[model samples]
Target chain A: MFDDRSPIYQQIANGIKDEVLSGTLKEDEQIMSTNQYAAFYRINPATAAKGFAQLVDEGVLYKKRGIGMFVSPDARGRLRAQRRERFFADVVDPMLTEARMVGVGVDEIVAYLKDGAR
Target chain B: MISLRDLTVRYGDTVAVDGITLDLEPNKIYGLLGRNGSGKTSLLSVLASYRRPCAGTVTIDGVDPFENAALMRATAFVRDSLDVTDQDRIAKVLDFAGRLRPTWDAGYAEHLADVFELDRRRRVSALSRGQRSSLGVVLGLAARAPLTILDEVYLGMDAGARAAFYRELLADYLAHPRTIILSTHLIEEVAGLFEQVIVIDRGRLLLHEDTDTFRARGVAVTGPAAAVEAFAAGRTVLGEQSLGGVRQVTLYGALADHEAEAARTAGLTLAPVGVQDLFVHLTAVGDTARTEALR
Candidate 1:
């Protein structure tokens, strides 16, 4: 199911990226056709197609003429690399900001993380 | 393409659909929304050529649809009121549509009947409201007309049945592309299916744009009353509510990326309003439309 947080097509594109990251959709694996995707998600075919188009543009997926879309051979690695690059800014920075706002010291946070690792 | 030139429809002293001009492209699903007595049905009736407009024109593929046998054959308008006899069976009703519709697919009709679990031998009079609605869905989808309009045919269907209908409709539409217009009050349920949406209020065109744009045009900013008011100042406030110093104001415009970031920093929650909430605020009684009219 989709939410109104962002455009449905963007959500669809992100969903495919997540699948690639999670290894649920293997590299070079044939993915659902836009029509099938649209029906499965109960969204407009055009919207689903737009999402696939976005993935293709991002080099995350490739299309086989007269066939369907497949995950790019480097899709998983590429996604992981991209997420890694943004991890500090998108994930870590936000957490640090929230922690600072709550007056949680970095030392205490590190201790808790080390304890959880045990 | 279908074009409407200053179309107007009247019944006695009641002006159902006031003068309105618009164009609807082919092979796209359009969601039409309007409040009760806001001329949604009358406008659809004219577009479907079920009734002649008192003034102006409606052209289908650059030709008049009224009394044009060729054009009529290519258009299917199915509403909740089943056009079959109460004493007749469901099979009889579908047979009549198949004979009349030039593009009718009997196989698909039968398939849809199975999907809806419709009893073909059951009399129309004995069918429940939901069953009758299912029959309407069969007729509309199986007709496969170039111009198919379904006017709230899911009136009596349960949530599961409605979900099935949406699935069937999207699948069939992908298989056979055509111009389809759906008029419904279930904005949240099916808004995603529409490529474009047309909203009318008080017999006037309120808005017609891509569904995505229509939804993105509004944002709900919620926070402390003073900050919310400051953020909403100089913006079109479509609706607002306040509870215990927390205020939420729905603004009718886009929120730029920087502005959204600023709002976040300012501790304001900038949320996107769903199509249904937007529609309610757009056409609710004594809402923006009435205020505009009064001004």
Candidate 2:
């Protein structure tokens, strides 16, 4: 289910982040153990552990010592803030660039967006 | 840790494994890769102590493994041509392994046999190719040795059977961590399971590094022929192909961020190359000519 564009660990971290943002994983919810994640994804447990470690480092997830991992209380808000910081450059800028290339004016795009909003 | 210092293996005049030095830390899965006749088996043989190194030395935790009772007993090496008696039933073969290997788990072995749907009453000779491979998986995983070397033990397994084997292997390994070395041609299928990858070519060490690092090494740049050529200039090109006005070149190194941005501005698409493609290009015959032509 993963791709070669990036390391599998990065993908795993991003996948968990996406789940958090989408509310599939609620804040303070207990998540699967690294072993379970590795088994489900058919990946090395070490790789899965690396991904979890990254999330822990980023404050997106927290460990319970002898227990399991839980989503950070502020993880969703923090992730949303991070994605908002890059939304224009990563998503809107490219859309605008493609629109400019195809001779689509900003007014037309605005009109379409307004129509969708209505 | 397992250390090999300038190890070599030879058969008569033919050198199967050239002088190579490597250190394997305990409790990690290593994928051993090589083309046929490239000495992968010989290297594994030396590691498993099935055959002594022609030169150099092999030590496990500061002691030689060859003929060492304790060390050898703690290492399980299962190959395609199993070392079991053809006339023995599957149950008997497993019983023999349990008796010899101190780490063998009979309960786990029985579970694996059920997972593979193997009939324990059937003789080894009567089993199908796929079944034999499954039996090998059972023996290798259930042994749970400190060092387990599976040299193409998946030879005759079908895709489904192989999937089960991979799952079982990973699950068991998680439960009981050990040093696992798998030598196989199925790079893409098994690449994810390897913490580190060791590739050998022509009886010599090609590359050994973290699996993620190795995966990041190969990049495929695709775009207009001239643009692709310009971007590929001064880079190590592993392989390339052209169709009409579009050209794609597989490169042997990761691109710098600025370089990637420049390629994007120039309308070139950079794609990651899979481990299998990288392995094929890296070990392809007559590599110099292909690389030289690009330069």
Candidate 3:
């Protein structure tokens, strides 16, 4: 289900990017048509089209003339690179801040990471 | 596009719709929200040409819709009260619609009947409440009129049937784009489908804007009563309540990211208000007075 905090189109675009990053949607693979996505999610077709349009703008998806949209050839790699750039700020920093608030030391986290690595 | 200028409707001494003006763009889904006796049905009836306004004008495509055959042919309104007669079978009713409705699609109607599990052979009187609502949906969608209005057509449907109807409605809408207006109290259930929303109260227009902006205006902040009150001081407070020592204030305004972050750091929890919650609070009697006073 989509959240109400941000525009639904942005959420749709992010959802597709997540799929690409997870290898569920491969490069050059045709994705569900806007109509199909709208029907499946019970959202307005215009909203879904907006999301797809955003992805197209970002080079994450490409239109096939009269056919439909396909994941761009470098979509996964590009998505991975973008997420990697934000991971520290968006994920790790928050984790570290929460850990600090809970009295979890950096050495404790390092030890836990080392044990999990084995 | 559709426009209503100072439109008003009255029944005996009661004013069902007060003077109001609104313009709706074409091919977009609109959600019409209101409390009971708030003139929602009356307003829609005027738009669909089911009733003539006592004053002002209702126009579709720049011409008066009242008794205008061409415009009437292009508008379809399905009210909670089924328009079909009790003597007619479901198939016979659809057949009648196919003959009268300019854009009626019999094939699609039949497909919808199958999906809704409606018995075409059954008499209108013999069907259950939910089945009748399903039949109403089928007629509305298959008509494919340029302007389609459904006033709480999901009145008796269960959750599953309602979900099915939403899916079919959105699909058909995408396949053939047209204007749609859905009037319902079930805001959260169908808010995602709306492009814009129009809310009315006591026969007067209260709010009309894109759904996102309307939703963003409502937010809830909860924490110590003193902090909650302080943070909500200058904002438009829709509603508020307290439990034990914790208090929550529902506000209607844009809260900047830094402001929200400050609230969080101050040990307050900020949450976005759902469409239903906002609708209820906005239309509630006491809150309406406060809102009007503020305006």
Candidate 4:
């Protein structure tokens, strides 16, 4: 859920992203309030709010003034797009680095990713 | 800026701050968070010019706070106790502050008194512990010092009051930015208010980092003991607990997506580590290690 090297808000953002991507969350669905998330997770509401705000900023969520944060209509797509953009930088680089160390070439790495996708 | 170089304080047999060096800048609200007996009060005392650091140098804007009248005048230190004599009435203390603090706004202080329903003529000695805490908060805010240090000033306040205080503190800080160092045990509650945070554990600096950077630093993994151990190999495991094959470990590092995926593939459940839990893991490990971390 968290690490000494990643911001808490980012972890929260990732958690919410998981829900959205998994279809547990829905388009235009009102997500839990900051206080609700905070109480449920036993974290500071501010921390939760920051996470929600980050999602809002990224267009994965939107605020309904005085109501609560709601998953955007295109939330899943938005997150998928953002994550896809960073996938290579975040995922592929390390994979390639690790693969190269083990004498696994680009073709083998590509084959493994293809297998995983299937 | 507030600077403490090799600061040390001793009270009888107790050594408070032991060779600490910290440079804190202005215009940011910092949470000077630590456990009890961590010398937070003593460090703030020296910074606020309320007490002299036994050894080392403490300077605010190039002036040693100890007995430095002008520097002390610009600083406000609010502890549960601010050395206000029991003989004085709460009103007198407010009145004294109103006169003494160059930035003191009497109207605002009176307004705070009204908000807290603090009776002016009531003796400070007769006040309840809760009320005393309220008074301390009142004085701290009303003083309006450039460097305002609140040392456990939220102790006696109820939940609602504490929430109100946080909101007002934030609002006030937003409106009139100043250097505020809040020393408290409520890490999660007030962690948001901090731009930069310094955690002193048992008279040592365990952590001093931007709130974002600090939060960016650790994670917990739960899984079978073998896989968990394997995943945690070459990583700093802050804490580990195992029951039969079920293992839970808190690791210190920036967890990347591949790392999380790796942990998942290795049959581990990734979880976020709480700052309080991290502090416990880091400090409870031992005095020697933590002390070295502080220096």
Candidate 5:
């Protein structure tokens, strides 16, 4: 099921990326065709196709002439690299901002992280 | 493509469709949305060639559709009512449609009947409201017309039946692509099935755009009253609510990346508004008054 908070196509693309990153979808693994995805999700085929097209544009998936879409060989690695690039700004920075607002010092956050590591 | 130019429909002294012009591409599902008395049915009737527009013109692939036998055969307009003789059995009605519709697939119709659990022996007058609706679904989907318009064909179906209808519709559409226009009051339930959304209000075209674009147009910003208010200051606020120190303002525009970042940095949480919620806000009584005033 998809939430309405963002474009469904974006969500679809993110979902496939997550699968690829988690190794659930291996390199060259053929995924559901856009029509199959549409029927499975009870969505318009055009919307589902748009999501698949976005993934292809980002090099996360590849087309196979007349067959179907397959996961790119470097999809997981590229996705991981992309996430790493945004980790601090998208995740840690927001967390640190919240921490600052709550009057928690950076040392306290560092100590908590150290404790969790153990 | 289907084109309508300044189309108008009137019944007696009342103008049902007023100078509405729109272009719909082929082979896409369009959600036709409108409040009660918004002329959605009137517009669809004209498109289906059930009636002529009082003014202006309607063309399908560069040909006038009104009373054009070939075009009529290519279009299927299934109304909320079954539009069959009460004395006829369900099987007989479908047989009639198959004889008239060049694209009608008897096998698909039978399959859809089974999916909807329709009894072929039942007379039209004997069927329940839900059963009648299911029959309409069978007719609309099985016809496989290039242009299929269903006008709130889910009027009395229960939740399970409606779910089945949606699933079957998507599956069949995938297998055999065609142009579909569904007019429904159940916006949230069927919004996902639409590639494009057309909204009409008070016999006027309100908006027509890709469904995703329409979905992204409304954003709800929630936070402290001051922060929320500040973020919504120059925006078109669709609706708002406040509880204790928290305020949520629903805005009618897509927020730019930096603007969304600014809201988040100001501690405001941005949420996407559902299509139903956006439609409600856009067609709300007060908003309609404001729209009329602006015009």
Candidate 6:
């Protein structure tokens, strides 16, 4: 559903981000070439290129010039940093706000995470 | 603003655009995506002032475009058929467009001809499909109309030519920006060109959204069947399939925090949906989020 509403490259960038966060892709790993990614995703090579550029901008991935994009040396760290930066407003804050409405306690959540971890 | 207001177009009894109402802003490229015979052409024709709608109005900047001479002059339609004289040569087409189109650029057209290796003396009807499309491109770019409409402008161009077209399009657009509406089947190739997208399915307005918001509208969640189902609960499911032990459900709507975290906890893949993926699913899908089923 490529539409005229927004540039497709932005979407391609987000797709790569999702792949990274999901661990389907690993840090310091080689990503597919532009042509390979395009054929695999059935996307335009230009769109894929734009996506890689976006990742490079976010420090999630970096280009090694003639080779291809590789998950950055600090890709996981960078992603974790970005996600952590947004955690309060995006996840923790929203979840807390919603939990308060349902009368759930912050202690309960922390305890749950601690237990969930174990 | 460009408006297609409750427009209905027909060819005798075959209804084209059933009734579409859209408000498009100025100075942007719009991608019109849909299946074959899905009324993308008819709707755009009305919008571009080429064909009048049967039941409603299409307006550019405020005036109805039907038979509106001023709008037609300001709007350039560079489709496969733009009513060229049968005997007119390729040079004549350029000359004609140069003379009639409000923003005609003769020098630019000549430059395009040189770039495409097109012979100025070659007649229009005698050209190949690729050449004809290039001619249309040349006309479209040089016309510089405020609103330029192209319906499948490149149907037969080879790979190299298509690449050339893309580069030229981007270069021209950057240098001389204008409102351009493109109707095409090659979604992925041109999706990046659009600033906005309008999807028309069987004459109905499926969606009109910014490229970013549209791309983030859905995601594919894949993993063990039960885990996927648990993670996907209450989401707008676009399409679904599964093996004996695993499933992948394409979900619509923005992915909230809880959902993302839950998916991670459950070990499900959360994939972002692309424009091509959305178009295919919407055109070929029959899902719960659909507004009206096109019969």
lDDT tens digits by residue: candidate 5, A57-85: 99999999999999999999999999999
Indicate which candidate wins on DockQ: 5
Q: Candidate 5 - CAPRI tier?
A: medium
Off by over 4 Å in 2: B288-295
Question: Residue B148 error for model 6, in Å?
Answer: 0.6
Error of 4 at B89 (Å): 2.1
Q: What is the TM-score of chain B in candidate 1?
A: 0.94
Off by over 4 Å in 6: A1-118, B285-295
Cα lDDT of model 3 by residue, A22-46, tens digit: 9999899999998889888888877
- Model 5 chain B lDDT-worst window of ten: B286-295
Model 6 docking grade: incorrect
DockQ (C-alpha based) per candidate is: 0.62, 0.74, 0.57, 0.15, 0.78, 0.09
For candidate 1 chain A, the 10 contiguous residues with the lowest summed lDDT are A1-10
What does candidate 5's lDDT look like per residue over B195-261, in tens digits? 9999888899988998889989898889999999888886777789999999998898788899998
Query: What is candidate 1's CA lDDT for residue B99?
Result: 81
The Cα error of candidate 3 at residue B292, in Å, is 1.8
What is the C-alpha lDDT profile of model 2 across B1-295, one tens digit per residue?
9998999999999989889899999999999998888898899899888999999999999999999999988989988888899999999999999998888999999999999999999999999988998999999999999999998988888999999999999998899999999998789999999999998887878788888889899999999999999999998888899999999999987888999999999999999999898999988885646534432
In terms of TM-score, which candidate is stronger, 2 or 6?
2
Instruction: List, residue by residue over B1-295, the lDDT tens digit for candidate 4.
Output: 8788989999998888888898998777888877888889888878877777889998777777778778778888888776698889998999888877789978878877777778999999998877888889889988888888899988778887787677667666655678888898787676666777898876777778877766656688999888888898888777788888899988876788998988888878988777667667666635565346334
All candidates: interface RMSD: 1.4, 1.1, 1.7, 6.3, 1.0, 7.6
What lDDT does model 6 reach? 0.78
Residue pairs clashing, model 2: none
- On TM-score, who's better, 1 or 2? 2
Residue B89 displacement in candidate 6 (angstroms): 1.8
DockQ of 5: 0.78
Sort every candidate by DockQ, greatest first.
5, 2, 1, 3, 4, 6
Top TM-score prediction, candidate number: 2
Q: Which 10-residue window of candidate 4 chain A scores lowest in summed lDDT?
A: A38-47
User: For model 5, what is the error of residue B87's alpha carbon versus the real structure, in angstroms, after optimal superposition?
Assistant: 1.5
True contacts kept of each: 0.49, 0.64, 0.53, 0.24, 0.76, 0.11
